[model samples]
Target chain A: MPYVNVKITNEGATPTQKAEVIAGITELLQRVLGKNPATTVVVIEEVDTDNWGIGGEPVTLRRRRGL
Target chain B: MPYVNVKITNEGATPTQKAEVIAGITELLQRVLGKNPATTVVVIEEVDTDNWGIGGEPVTLRRRRGL
Candidate 1:
């Protein structure tokens, strides 16, 4: 079983968008890796900007500084 | 950098619990794989029962059928 995790900043992604992402990733793995969609687990995580970091700083501060 | 994603059913896990999970995973990676905690990313995704699937059925249906 292939477990895929997609992490994205919490920017109000709609349910439809989340569904599409799950389907797309499942289909991609099936097409490219011959993986079974039924056994493949795709998890989507929407992280708060304050908890997401880059370049040793949180995304909130990065966005605040317009970086 | 090692990225770890923990997926669990939406069961009222508190922020403190989530933080502990992150910290625990980070420390585990550091001890086992020599990964840097600063660069290690741990994401926790609490999925709805309706969305989580097992054995060709959603968890919601499985729970309803008492499987």
Candidate 2:
């Protein structure tokens, strides 16, 4: 079975929101990519602002310095 | 930084196509989600026809039995 790993960082997402996103992805894969929902596994990883980056720069630092 | 994992099954996809998809995803995350491309990780899994399924059914068996 095809394995799809999806990680999205959303500081404001609640547990329910995370679950919804996973379900949505599963549905999308089944309909769009024709993947088997049974075999498809979705993994969601939430990263804190400190651990994330943008344009090869640390997001936390940028936000803190107002850069 | 946001991590988005995309899994697509394409029996006809080449290695180059896979790389292209990864790049596209990275770019999309940067533009759409304002994620850092440096920290974004994309993993693509290629499932064999026999190993994949659809609609809670085994895709391989369906294709084989011509169902």
Question: Which residue pairs collide in model 2, if any?
Answer: A1-B51, A5-B5, A6-B5, A7-B3, A36-B53
Reference-based lDDT, residue B58, model 1:
49
The regions of model 1 sitting more than 4 angstroms off are B1-6, B11-45, B49-67
> Predicted candidate 1: what Cα RMSD to the true structure?
7.0
Q: Residue-wise lDDT of candidate 2 within A1-67, one digit each (tens)?
A: 4455666655566676656656665665555455577866767666777666676776677877885
Model 1 residue A66 CA deviation (Å) reads 3.1
Instruction: List TM-scores for all candidates, in order.
Output: 0.57, 0.55
Give the least accurate 10-residue stretch of model 1 chain B, judged by summed lDDT. Answer: B50-59
Best candidate according to DockQ? 2
lDDT of 2 by residue, B1-67 (tens): 4556564544666677566656765665555456678877776656666656776776677777885
| Stretches of candidate 2 exceeding 4 Å from the true structure | A65-67, B13-67
Worst 10 residues of 1 chain A by lDDT: A14-23
User: What local distance difference test score does each model get?
Assistant: 0.78, 0.63
What is candidate 2's CA lDDT for residue B26? 65
On a 0 to 100 scale, what is the lDDT of residue B32 in model 2? 47
**lDDT for predicted candidate 1 compared with the true structure:** 0.78
